[model samples]
Target: MVIFGCVGIIAGCGSLGLWLANRIRRRPVELREFLMALSLLDTEIVWGATPLPEAFGILKERTDAPWQGFFADLQDRLQRGESASIAWNDVSLAQNSHFCLKHEDWQVIRDVSKGLGRSDRQEQHKQLELIQRQLALIKDQAGIWSEKQAKMWSYLGFLCGIAGVLILI
Candidate 1:
């Protein structure tokens, strides 16, 4: 009886641990989505005369998702008067954030910061395209991972059920 109980306990704990791990692994996906949306917002506001803080604040408030932590971090960094490029780099470090500012975009932002006229607006669309691609890639990976998890958990549950039956027998 003790042996059966021990086995059951261990299996239960293992199953729970696996489930938790799967849940935690999904954070990166959410992070990427938040970054994508934030980037798009930045693009839309780039040509506006609105102060970065005010624009960012409005975007943050309007964002209807569980990204307060991410947005707050970005807002804090921006409030420090950090350059947009640098702020973007920081934001890109979050999990699921696969974006890296292209050299062209970086050059454009940097030149503008140094008092050069705003570079052409072409790069914003390119960057948005890149973000879309990244989102699609992450979505694909998440789908595969979830499918695999479903199969794995099904097998695990089946085995656990069989084991329990053997124990009761």
Candidate 2:
């Protein structure tokens, strides 16, 4: 009974650590994929002239969850007649926000979301290009940060679990 209890405790701790580490590891990849989705949106808008709801619907198809969920939520909001800025703010930041974007990233997007369809086509293109550049920088930073933190978090969790077992013993 005692041996089984100890094994369970250690395993639980290690699993927790691994889960935390995996979350840290995946964040950068999520951001990168999000950038791709945004770029795809740019393409559909610039070339296809697809409206928000349709463009977002295309994005939802291209992406995976929680990102897929983000785009779907956006589609829903747009269908509900929410403005681009409000939909983005409410959906991206408030709802389905498992995405761990930095505040600056959100600000960059939120700022651009405000002007989404208000301007002429050429102006909207320029705004999108600018947003693309900002998102690129964010993607790069996320990659760097994730590389640094992911392994550390994982090992830290595993070690903490072992330490917990040791303390118990």
TM-score of each: 0.55, 0.88
**TM-score result, candidate 2:** 0.88
- CA lDDT of each candidate? 0.53, 0.79
Model 2 agreement with the true structure over 4-103: per-residue lDDT tens digits: 8777877887788778777767767776787788788888888889998999999999999888988898999999998877788788677436866667
In candidate 2, stretches whose alpha carbon ends up further than 4 angstroms from where it belongs are none
lDDT of 1: 0.53
lDDT of 2 at 90: 82
Model 2 RMSD in Å is 1.8
Q: Pick by TM-score: which candidate is best?
A: 2
- Using lDDT as the measure, which candidate wins? 2
lDDT of 1 by residue, 12-44 (tens): 856865664555455455536555664655465
lDDT measured at residue 126 in model 1 versus the true structure, 0 to 100: 55
Q: What are the clashing pairs of model 1?
A: none
